[model samples]
Target: MIIEQSHFLFVSLYIFAISIGGLLLNRRNIIILLISIELMLLAINLQFVIFSVFLDDIIGQINALLILTVAAAESAIGLALLVVYYRIKGTISINKINLLHG
Candidate 1:
């Protein structure tokens, strides 16, 4: 059994669709939103890997590594902000974040 570029692209498309759906379907949950964002990043990283493999290039993999690093930092900061917000508000609902407004 051999895998092809089309198969990789198809899987990437499915992941992208699911990530978008996750982002759109749940408007109130901050955790779900963060997970969706991570999914989207993973889907993009999948594309970068696929293209790099097909093109016989190393740059795509390097860029994907950079993206992963940035995603990690983003997730850490986002979770920290979530923790602070929850400490103050006792909830992680997006609808309730307006309380941060002065």
Candidate 2:
């Protein structure tokens, strides 16, 4: 049990670290943004699994599946938005976007 629990903790922490790193590295590159989003999703999934294992409950697994579906939808929407932005501005820099009109 100790080994299994430790493994779960290690995996969860690793995923969290990757997600943080990805977000920190976000830049004008749309690909990096997408990757960061993916890493964040992966981290959530890892936590769900770890908790599910710790509690010996199926709900965690179910929640993890739901999270994956949501993540996919989010990525699709985000990519679509990025495409629209790029088409309009000819660049994907988040810093340059200021479409809000006062």
On lDDT, the candidate that comes out on top is: 1
TM-score of each: 0.94, 0.81
Relative to the true structure, how large is the alpha-carbon lDDT of every model?
A: 0.94, 0.82
Model 2 regions more than 4 Å off: 1-3, 100-102
Q: What's the distance in Å from true for residue 37, model 2?
A: 2.7
What is candidate 2's lDDT per residue for 1-102, written digit by digit as tens?
Answer: 347777877887887788788778766776787877788788778888888888989998999999899989988898898888889989877678788546
lDDT of 1 by residue, 1-102 (tens): 899999999999999999999999989898999999999999999999999999999999999999999999999999999999889889888787897689
Weakest 10 consecutive residues of candidate 1 by summed lDDT: 92-101
- After superposition on all CA atoms, how large is the RMSD of candidate 2? 2.4
Q: Rate residue 44 of model 1 by lDDT.
A: 95
Q: Candidate 1, 31: how far from true, in Å?
A: 0.5
